[model samples]
Target: MKLLTLPSFLLLFFETAILSNFVTADTNVHYLDNNEFFKFSNPRQIYGTKPLHIFCYQGKPKYIIHIWQSVILYINHSTDDYNQFDGGSPEHVEKEYLEKRYSWTSGLFSSKSKTFHLNPFNTSCIGIESQDTYSVHLKIIRVDLWNILKLVAGIVFFLSAPTLSKNTLFHYVCGVSSGVCASFLILIYFLSKLFPRKTFMYGVIGAGWTLVIYFLQILWDNMKTILSLYRTYVIWYIVITGTISFILCYRWGPVQNQRTMNLIKWSLQLLGLLLIFFSSHFQEAAMAQVILLLLFTYVPKRWVLAPKMYWKKRFPPKLKPISNDEYYEQGVRETAKALDDLRKYCSSPECNQWKTALKLKDVKRFASFIEGNSHLSDEEILEYETSIREEVTDDSDNGEDAQFSEDESS
Candidate 1:
């Protein structure tokens, strides 16, 4: 073959690059949740692609890990590797293909902008070190596991409270039913805020809605009986409880501090319990049932389950490794961009640690795997990053000052 000029070679390479990498749908990826496995074709892009087109506040992408046939993945923070995965790596597939993106809202409004397209990882024409291009030996130092069963139990009790309302509280059952549904709805909203990524968020939201629908249907069926109870005494109960609940929620509902909010919530719950006990319609059965509902619905979740979830979310969990093929997937790329936006909020040391850990083929690959799976929105992620940075910096300064004082005394 005749020698081509450097520019001509580059142009030809670019032209052929569109066909250089081909990824199959069967590529498996491990998610942070240990029990879950993801395929390359369907990477869990939680924030979706809409945020990618906007450059202002992108967040961390899900981690992309590529491996050769002998693949064992691990994630390590500091010196410890806490998680490991084994993907069947019989052989490597090398084929190049063109990629494009399609938005869910494309047809809603006419836009001339073409979806982003690229060619990813066709190693046929070039040779790169395996260690540089893939995760050859992976180790993860720290990861925390969540108890899904506890969350499920909380949800089940929350949804079942309506059933318990039928026999107890007598004339007050209607109000109690409505109140139970409303309280669970509020709890669901708080869980979504607290553990956005966990299945608990979706579970509570769906179950809460189902409970509301069930309650409304029952209310409609028993409207005549319920309204009959709405005479002077019952009406008074309705008005008083409703007013107190409303005032408590309205005043303390928006408070961002979790501990403070929980304190207020528990105090109000105790007051509600006392009110129900002393109400004219109260029966021993009603009191007992109410106690069970509260025990199952609020007690375990607020005091036991939610705090664990909050801890996991605060520290984040393990990251799974993915391949270059998975990294180049449309969903992965957008998520990676979002992750980068979130990473911008981390401290320089943390950011540098990310760079060292991910050893991605490009900066985009390095952008993968945000601290908390990008569950928080971009703004929230930034706030988290800022607080973490300040805390770490302050601690470091304190350490330095103590060291200096000791040295001076010596």
Candidate 2:
């Protein structure tokens, strides 16, 4: 006799082709974890210069041209490895930026730096870090004026192509609007990272959203031509279901729990596939429908960049220390509350053991805090660190979320 868990049982019962579809769908979606990269170097060697590369956020991953946000390249001058210039450890590096840690304010390394913005769109680092200098290189994308022009021009050509060298004025206008709006939306996302000042940042976001609404209006008008009653119901179902699922996962999902993450991730893939399949069914409106869905998904989420700094502005509470009891109880899965607790951990006088101190919760905002601070009691820190080590070493733990559907074919 054999007993199987839901995912296993389902996998066994389903046809190989249908199971393959599930696997393929899961693999196609991009996750931030899949792209993380980091490196540290001697500060002086990389000082006063810039290196160029594209990032993942700018577009889909490309050879060397895509903007990437997963890796962070940091140069600490106070390290013992390089005594020629003043070298500092990661902890020492954090001290210099402590005042700005929890706020929405954004700037470069220091006042003496040449670059005004830390995450400049076109250039890499353009500053100095002699006395405890920290030149941070993050994986971020920048869409500049030239890139915008090129994107708009390309969209115009593509929209005109199907018309066989004689495109209607309305089509040309829509193409131009599509390109300009998308590029500007990208610009807003980049600007939010480079300079996260509240008023300016939110203003750009509001304007960009207005443009998005206008674009959606255009798509809706076109959608009416080809959408049958059945397709309309399917689209509305997807829209409502997708919106609810997104809210539930984003608002309540535990950041540290692998199980919750998997559920949210798979749900997104399913929704994306369903939406695309339905949208593409109407040949007359297929291109517009897909384009609208892509833009809708991409535009809003782009501003929520990785790395604690880029997202701090989204959370506005002042950073003050909280007791461990206060943290685990009231702070569990609450971003603002967890961040405040992490601040307490950072501000602790003994904040050098932070990496091994706190437990991993969903509030990844605490990552930078842990990097250089460790203020827990020795016993507490030891316990936390030991649990982390144990978890890392024990690698045979793979489980799936609960079952969702029946086997269509066996």
Candidate 3:
């Protein structure tokens, strides 16, 4: 894309404003008691609970995890009379009744957490009112399990699924996943600057970032009323995380060139950081940004020395096996023995590794399997290349062909 034009700048300027007002104006203003800057006061005086036993932020996409947690605390701590809006004196705001956002114009979000549309994670609960004598309990589970789940799934599916990672598919998976992982850490550093969710970045991204993104359905499936205290926690987590994925996929994930690849990653991530404040203000518009972002995701971008770039990015001398000869020697021998058992189970020792490890049969059979997949991946890659080679006019993606190359190189 080119530099922003005058018209483009003006358009985005107003877009950002409208977006900001929409997000901030119609949401809850009092969720936390972070002095007066926050929307709500502490739960100590408001309810009978011993403050919320909230899990401090653990980083990842839910940057404002702490802020959302505080809201849960206040809600869970209130008694029946806390905010009996309709009953008795309609002066008190029930603990269960919370403003959805921090906007001044928007009144409190009366819909229970479980009822919010975006809150597909069946988490929100019916706001229960306990007496001052009853104590409140708010528990926060889930410790970056989503990220781990994704990594495991990707590794297994890519390794097993036929035609999925043939050409350079394997390598591309490695490369893109590596880049994604790196970008996630980078995202934490940059995002923390704006929303400073209290959590250790290292632990959040350690080895579980991908799994957290994967198991989101679990949250969606479990809609327990007691989960009300943690409703904001789950909802905010899904929206921000999903939005980040949407934004990154459209921007950095599609590019080529190591320098450009990293550049695209960092630039978009930072821009998202700046825009996220706007998200809290205008949730809908903030979400729309991703849809607006799709305009660029499929549009092709050019590259120089594309092959060289792919090789260098995907397969450096350091990463290659010390000697393909010795490595494949044993593999070939084992594979050959298994060739004899062709129709039947090839229990040969050599082919045993592939058979057991990959769940393939004899060595020759596994090789055939790999070759079959390679053919399919190759065909797909060729098609991708054909689409992208010609001036990139309404063609396929740049990275689509990279999968084929990954297969060849592997």
Which candidate should be chosen as best, given TM-score against the real structure?
Answer: 3
User: What RMSD, rounded to one decimal, does every model reach?
Assistant: 37.8, 38.4, 29.5
| Model 1 misplacement above 4 A | 1-15, 20-74, 77-155, 163-410
**Local accuracy of candidate 2 as per-residue lDDT tens digits, 1-410:** 25548778777766575545433321111112222443333334444322211112112333323321122333333432221111133223333333333235534221221112222222222222232333333333333343334334444433433332232343344434444435547656887877758888888787887767765565554464447545777466556655554554446432445554455454444454444433221223434544664565556664445445555767866979889899777755686667667777666776765564466553354555555443355798799999988886664332111122223332
TM-score of each predicted structure versus truth: 0.16, 0.15, 0.19
**Model 3 segments more than 4 A misplaced:** 1-79, 84-131, 134-142, 146-410
TM match of model 1 to true structure: 0.16
Q: Residue 229: error of model 3 in Å?
A: 22
Per-residue C-alpha lDDT of model 3 across residues 1-410, encoded as one tens digit per residue:
34658789888997798666544322221211222121233435543432211111112233333212212222333333332121111112222133322236333433222111111121222223223433323334333343334334433432343333232434344455554434455665665566445555445555356544443344444457427778887566556665555565556444345665445444444454344323232334435544544333434444435777798889876765548688779887887666545524433444554436465334554555434333234777888888766746534555667777899999
TM-score between model 2 and native: 0.15
How many times do residue backbones clash in model 2? Answer: 25
